[model samples]
Target: MYRKILITTDGSAVSQHTACAGVKFAQQMGAEVLALFVAPDYQYPVYVEIIPPSYPSEEEYVAQMRRLGEEYMGKIMRSCAGANLQHACMTAFSDTAALKIVDVAEQEGCDLIFMGSHGRSGWGQLLLGSVTNKVLSHTTKPVLVHRLISEPASG
Candidate 1:
């Protein structure tokens, strides 16, 4: 049913697990995949002398993050073998990752999004809302959220 799929990765285990699943889904549906990695804006304070301030410049930190992101994306691309799915990776340093996912999907004409949920609960979930939650709440496209960690058995 899906012609194009968008998969967002933060280089987490759950994200990688979901990526594997997405590759399978894309293969089954004969769809292309667009994988994205967002470099969060890690800002630092500016300094004049050799003894720098507590925080580094936002520009330098962001560049470092972007380089790391690119390396991670390279690994992701190299890992996808035998699926024969057409895929591309993108890195956006300053943008909100959730929104970037949506924007890429729209730009690529994606019909489906495959992502992983950490399944945070109670206070944790409340305090640190997940990207999956945001994407689900905001997007008009169909999303499949995979729970990476299996739940404990009940009595």
Candidate 2:
């Protein structure tokens, strides 16, 4: 039984669904939930000398990302409230989301991590590295990955 659960979200529809489910799972286990949103760090242009006019400043980027995190975390908050589960939420700025998630889980003493996997495979997965996969590889803590089921294409 998990005493504390770490639920991670990236604001995607699948992640939102998984977060809600994770909240429900925590409620069932009578565990406290720590909802986390990891926003990508602001990246500098490769050609610093030729910065694009529309490019956001670091401050502007952080502010925007924070707002987005709030929106995403808000859903988890509502779910926790509805479930009457003890919970807290935070947003972290980190490009390495997998590392950040593992670090937060350890730092917070979470017994379990609940997160969503997009289920990409083969070349797609290789080209676009999976955060869930990385978390699985790097962390010794228990991770429950909720994979989104895709509907079969209509002929």
* Number of backbone-clashing residue pairs for each candidate, in the order shown: 0, 0
How would you encode candidate 2's per-residue C-alpha lDDT over 1-155 as one tens digit per residue? 89999999876666677888899899999999999988888899999999999999999998998888889899898888888888989889887888999999999999999987752345533422478889999999999987657622322
Q: With candidate 1 superimposed using the best TM-score fit, by how many Å does residue 77's alpha carbon deviate from the native?
A: 1.6
Maximum-TM-score candidate: 2
Of candidate 2, the 10-residue stretch with the lowest lDDT total is 119-128
TM-score, candidate 2, is 0.85
TM-score of each model, paired residue for residue: 0.75, 0.85
C-alpha lDDT of all candidate models, in order: 0.69, 0.84
Residue 116 in model 2: lDDT: 77
For candidate 1, the clash count comes to 0
What TM-score does structure 1 among the candidates reach? 0.75
